[model samples]
Target: MAVHRSRRWSFGGLALLVSAGLASAVLINTSDAATNRANAATVTTTTTFSDDFDGAAGSAPDSAKWSLETGGSGNGNHELEYYTNSTSNAALDGKGDLVVTARKNTDSGLQCWYGTCQYTSARLNTAKTFTQKYGHFESRIKVPKGQGVWPAFWMLGDDLGSVGWPGSGEIDVMENVGYEPGTVHGTIHGPGYSGAGGLGAAYTLPNGTSFADDFHTFAVDWSPSAITWSVDGQTYETRTPADAGSNKWVFDHPFDIILNFAVGGDWPGNPDSSTSFPQTMTVDYVHVTTSDSGSTSGSTGGSTGGTTRTGAIKGIGGMCVDVAGGSSDDGTPIQLHNCTGNDAQKWTLGSDGTVRALGKCLDVKAASHDDGAVVQLYTCNGTSAQQWTYTSAKDLTNTGADKCLDAKDNSSADGTRLQIWTCSGNANQKWTVG
Candidate 1:
């Protein structure tokens, strides 16, 4: 039996509201933004890597890049024994591939942070080791069987600590449980209703065969405009920011990858008595690739260099109107006023790449400069504040100092704010070219 603790993090909700507010205000007139630019530049095609990992040795194991999460103790109906370089739980190599096995512990002696659970398992990640901005990510995996078992290959923004969990963004390339053997899910999570509120689509394997029975290639083709999920080479689901309202879309940033097998939780539910113990998730290898010439496509349109608008500001709410100038400055209280085509509301994209509006350059709030600061327009200083770089590959980079435009606090609310921060190389910083 495992005991779980539930604590409400109000700050997360507040941050989301702020983020929504900001996005709404700045993103208004999305159509106008779209009309401003011409067609984008053509994309050059290139392959980043094609790996088989069939070598007898010198192959990269989960160990080189993954770390486990332990002590979950059945919290959220979870069944895995937490493996944190401590006692009972550990990751091992089974033959040629990496294996994460879950076992039942007979002894009631071990205690977990939440309470008690008689199980152990492994969860792995590439937090500090490596991360990809945009590319085709694929993995050959063999899932475990029995109810309550939840297996997943996913990605999260690398800036977890600074920006927090869902705020940083989550991408579930593949997720399946024992009960739903033939169905796999792909989803994205951000501020508003992340975690339990994650939004996604699902695919059912053909021939009545469950993914648990064989090694299947689970992959995601991630680009600026859309993200498509596939099994083997078959695409099952696709999501685009344009499809959903802008508030629900945040896949434009960089995200780190993760693989894990959990026992149960709010979504998968706990396993029953018939559930088997000592289940395993075998991973053959993971591969990542990007185009060489730097061109990609999707709903957001390609980068052409002429004025091209990919997305736009929809509506502004709760913005202070009486503020002095629209110049980009630190701590400027941004307000929502009627669109006057004035410099304040007229955000301009300079050929030099700066986002200027209201006589000010788009500025990071005081450069508090932390991961979650709000974004505001300030007077142009030609400092990093006014320098922007557009990539033919469909991402916007802050050439000013390698920094990137960020949503304040990573919130997904209607009035959340925006700001500039040091680039964590996450998808949130990745902007589509159009």
Candidate 2:
């Protein structure tokens, strides 16, 4: 099982999630941050592979770039669905889309690897004819509605047969649980950091717009050392080897891409009374580009910029805001620890007033303004507690509270708790970047 990590999610550009107690469409206003990010993600160049789903109605996925992964053994998620290669489960619609449907399992006598098959869906992968080390990968997809529908576009290391799981690595470009249709998840799983402990982020749409209402583009700009995830064209998150604490960086190798719609798993749980069957994941297109020209990624800029925004945020004691135990949970103490060039210690300052790492905002607990409110990682909600400013003097301040981020007791030790205190102009309250 993938261990669940505490995470950060932002409502920056959420216009609406159209729903009547269920996720539907999302309104993307031009002024929304998510919209801007989505638009920013679409700038592109030369392509290595592009599929518009223009195949004849009911045709299978291109045999050259994709193959079916079939089974019902839950694939380790204890899911209730049976993955099959049947055309009925995955076929091209006459309307320029590839529709992968999940229906009630009619094969009463068919046995799953673990239990009885209760549902049936399709799983496709680009393993045999397609594998790449780094580049941009994007897809235009419309996820299914109703609870229990788990749609995803992801990738796995091509060396899965040789190294297995965490060693092979997994990059989830996009995954949407039916219940949270307005939200999308991007994650990376690798040695010592697979499953729920995966480094991840979430992008949610505004209210009144259901993702199921229309198609949206989800993409990732991947390079040798980093990967940036985006929705539409808006880049929201990026992960790199530095984020991998003591874990092995397993993403430098080639990987095979995958697309699937699962039902009833540990994350989404099982279907309920209101859950609808016959869910479908519609795909308008899939494209891969090799051009790094004009690419936008958190790791896109020059490394030697000497800016604190791209590297460690060192404090008066030369300590940094380190991830506790290399854990990626939200609320992980942003303490002053010995600086290490890992994702846990990386901090990026955004024009949006956020100091972020691992796709989460550095937040003050509860927006409190008390004498000793501690700072922690939280979902970036654009809240006052999240609004911050790193000054020229190198002090990290909560602009909303006007308090300097302080390392408790002037401590420079590992595991020291961090808090907000009135500026004292002391070295203990000072900080530096890069």
Candidate 3:
């Protein structure tokens, strides 16, 4: 069994090499045009999440979608870098890239497992912002060079705090050790099959090209029963339960995405004189597309499995969603009102992803997708503009606009109009569909 190459090391400082044979696992390349189309036609996909790093240069990652992890505890891998929340270590490039840099530590005075921190880098995760079960998660990254560097794009089960470590499951969508310039690995860790024993395969680029030479896409198409790895649109290996070696398959639950660059660890040894300072991992973009067959537990307003749930949508300040003047007209304003249990406040989460009151559908005015688009009660028309999804996070989103149903100006006054706005996971956009 290969020792898990990158993780919080817990084997009493045991240093083992990942079996060279593991790299020999068969690569199921799908570079053929026919194969690509056939694979694409099998599943209908929808964009669920994306981050293009389009912010101004030196700006921090979006707080609504990513959180920086700061520490020097070696992340259980005996790494030498002190992870910092500073933009000096991670920030947008303005040219649409998230640059994560690892530089020689100077006078920060940060301590590491080895007494003093020798490097400074950054690590970011989406644990608080988002989590998804089965989807196509991908990122385009240009890796850095140097023997002691380690860059990874991965995910951990959302229940990590509860179950802990390997029990919580890990999916290493892509990991590259600086020494292995031409190859990347994808692995999964869980109970009974963790660390070096993780199930996955290594993929090497054709020719003698080094990954550090340019950007390349790394992705995983995850399903309930399997996870397929790919590079630059080329399908590689796929892992399934049968490969778990009798242990349980734990990838069925939601997981949060993580990206980081490390310096010196159990897998990639300490930097030597030949190693360079200030290595960086440049990320072009990160995207996750959900499958039509998959279920997003925290997704807002969508079909309720054919069940029509009639109730009041209690929102901020405990106000219920209401239709102005209890009207059934084609364009009646939707508002926040005191819970009166009247027809104007009664709503039904229909089987077709429609929210209705008085036979009128909750809709985005003029089918607009702009922020602050007015939300109104319009005659049911079976159109995308009328579709809404209620997520576990209490967000009621207008599907056509891909925005959350928000209380205008964050007000809860009796006639505060409803509007559609970017989902910021704020109190103004939260609702309880009872």
* Best candidate, TM-score: 3
The TM-score obtained by model 2 is 0.59
Candidates sorted on TM-score, descending = 3, 2, 1
Candidate 1 steric clashes: 56
lDDT of 2 by residue, 1-434 (tens): 22332221112101110000000001122343323333323322345566788888988877766777776767677678877888899999978899999999989876775667889998877666666666567788999988878888887776666666667777888888877878889898877776778988988886657789998888776665567776754556778789999889887666666788988877877888888778899999887654322222221221110111346778866778776776647788778787778877876654334576765778899898776899888866768798665555556677677777888888888888888987776777777765
List clash counts for every candidate, in order. 56, 40, 14
The lowest-lDDT stretch of 10 consecutive residues in candidate 3 is 17-26
Q: How much is 29 displaced in model 3, in angstroms?
A: 27
Instruction: Give the whole-model CA lDDT for all candidates, comma-separated.
Output: 0.52, 0.68, 0.73
Candidate 2 vs candidate 3: which has greater lDDT? Answer: 3
Q: Least lDDT summed over 10 consecutive residues: which range in candidate 1?
A: 17-26
- Segments of candidate 3 deviating more than 4 angstroms: 6-44, 298-434
- The alpha-carbon deviation from the true structure for residue 224 of candidate 1, after best TM-score superposition, in angstroms, is 1.5
